[model samples]
Target: MRHIHDAPAGLIDFLFTELLLSLKDQGYSEFSLGSVPLAGLEARRGARFSARLGAYIYHHSTQFYNFEGLRSFKEKFDPEWRSVYVAVPPGANIVAVVADVVRLIGGGGRDRVGGKASR
Candidate 1:
């Protein structure tokens, strides 16, 4: 899941279509979408959708959150994790996730979590 606002349009839709087709092709007729919150990430509507879609496709990201961290976070809600992949265009800037994580942790170099900026 873990999609930023910058993700390309139709990306989620295409993924869903492919996933459903793949599952049917594999003779699976029963499936359900689940959702969980990312550890320490902001809780928003987009985040909620990302988590649900991620759970549906069993997709996990490794940039901002590690498998261990995601596992721990999702385990609180008793979710099952499945492995998936994203095929990025060659030379695309795929480091946005990492950069976002850095910004969040580094607080844009101010080290602020709330209204107080760290020195």
Candidate 2:
């Protein structure tokens, strides 16, 4: 999904359409483009600390992630988005839960396969 923004107008769209058509020909009825982290988060009254933090990061962390562009690219397909939720038990620290989820994303202490990403 990491495409050059300078690509000619409609080039990305053409490619995406072809890909989807190919998948359909393969008898695939659905396609998942995966999660766009920090996308669609909003800050409002009574929002949880984690939600607010996610919103702030989404707005200010473009140097690290092109959240807006990615979200826009994914939206072209009329995709359905699922909500992300974190469960914190009583007395649990939200920061710790977030950190653990991040760790799980980055190899998660699992043994690498052929020195590549985790299985």
Candidate 3:
């Protein structure tokens, strides 16, 4: 679920509707729209600068990812979003671990098969 380059308005709506209907006919009632990175992040009171910076990037950086748009699109289907988190071992380099994860999950320098990007 990425951008529709030069696609006509409502094209995505049609495609999603068709896909959902097909899935329903195939006896699949539950559809999982994949996770949107940082879409539901929350900073507790007295949060640190890193947490605030991450939230800012998630909300504003459309060139990197359409985070807000993806969440809005998924909401149209009446999804029940559950919070998910990742844990790292104590004393590990959190920054490096997160960088690796970004490369892995963000398809950094990946090839595309058909119309979809893959790593």
Candidate 4:
């Protein structure tokens, strides 16, 4: 897998946008925008749609810097949390995965193992 660390911020933004667009194109009309602070609080306000059919599906993070806090927060929404995984090629450096996980968790350090600078 191509590391996000090597990509420019513009590209990363573009890719994220592309992913959203792709989800929309794939019939995900009522996509839930998540990961913002207090997402659970907002979700508890009530369904975006009527009771007959729920308006939006909550997409939540399985991993958080504060895992317990995040899990507790998301649980308030009664979301059906799912597991997601990345399929990498055989013999991929585990450190890359570790660095990626750290980065995702807001670890803002240069990727010395890959000789890449964090933006």
C-alpha lDDT score of every prediction, in listed order: 0.49, 0.71, 0.69, 0.45
TM-score for each candidate, following the candidate numbering: 0.29, 0.68, 0.72, 0.34
lDDT of the structure predicted as candidate 1 = 0.49
In what order do the candidates fall by lDDT, top score first? 2, 3, 1, 4
- How close is each model in CA RMSD to the real structure? 16.7, 4.8, 5.3, 15.4
Model 1: residues with Cα > 4 Å off, grouped in runs: 35-119
Preferred candidate (lDDT higher): 1 or 3: 3
Model 2 poorest 10 in a row by lDDT: 110-119
Residue-level lDDT of model 2, residues 1-119, one tens digit each, is: 54687888888789989999999999999998776766777888798777887788768767755667778888988998997765668766665564455444434637643232332
Model 3 residue 90 CA deviation (Å) reads 4.5
Evaluated at residue 76, the lDDT of candidate 1 is 45
Q: Comparing candidate 1 with candidate 4, which one achieves the higher lDDT?
A: 1
Please estimate how well model 2 matches the true structure, expressed as its whole-model Cα lDDT. 0.71
- Per-residue lDDT tens digits for candidate 1, residues 1-119, read 55679999767657766887899999997555432223333344666444454443323555534544544544543445554434445554435433443344434646555443332
* Candidate 4 lDDT over residue span 1-119, tens digit each: 13467677557446656876898899886544234222332343654322112112123334433434555644554555544444546665644654464464454544555444364
Per-candidate clashes, comma-separated: 0, 0, 0, 0
Scanning candidate 4 in windows of ten residues, the lowest lDDT window is 49-58
Pairs with backbone N, CA or C atoms under 3 Å apart (clashes), candidate 1:
none
TM-score of 3: 0.72
The lDDT leader among the candidates is 2
Q: What C-alpha lDDT, on a 0 to 100 scale, does residue 90 get in candidate 4? A: 67
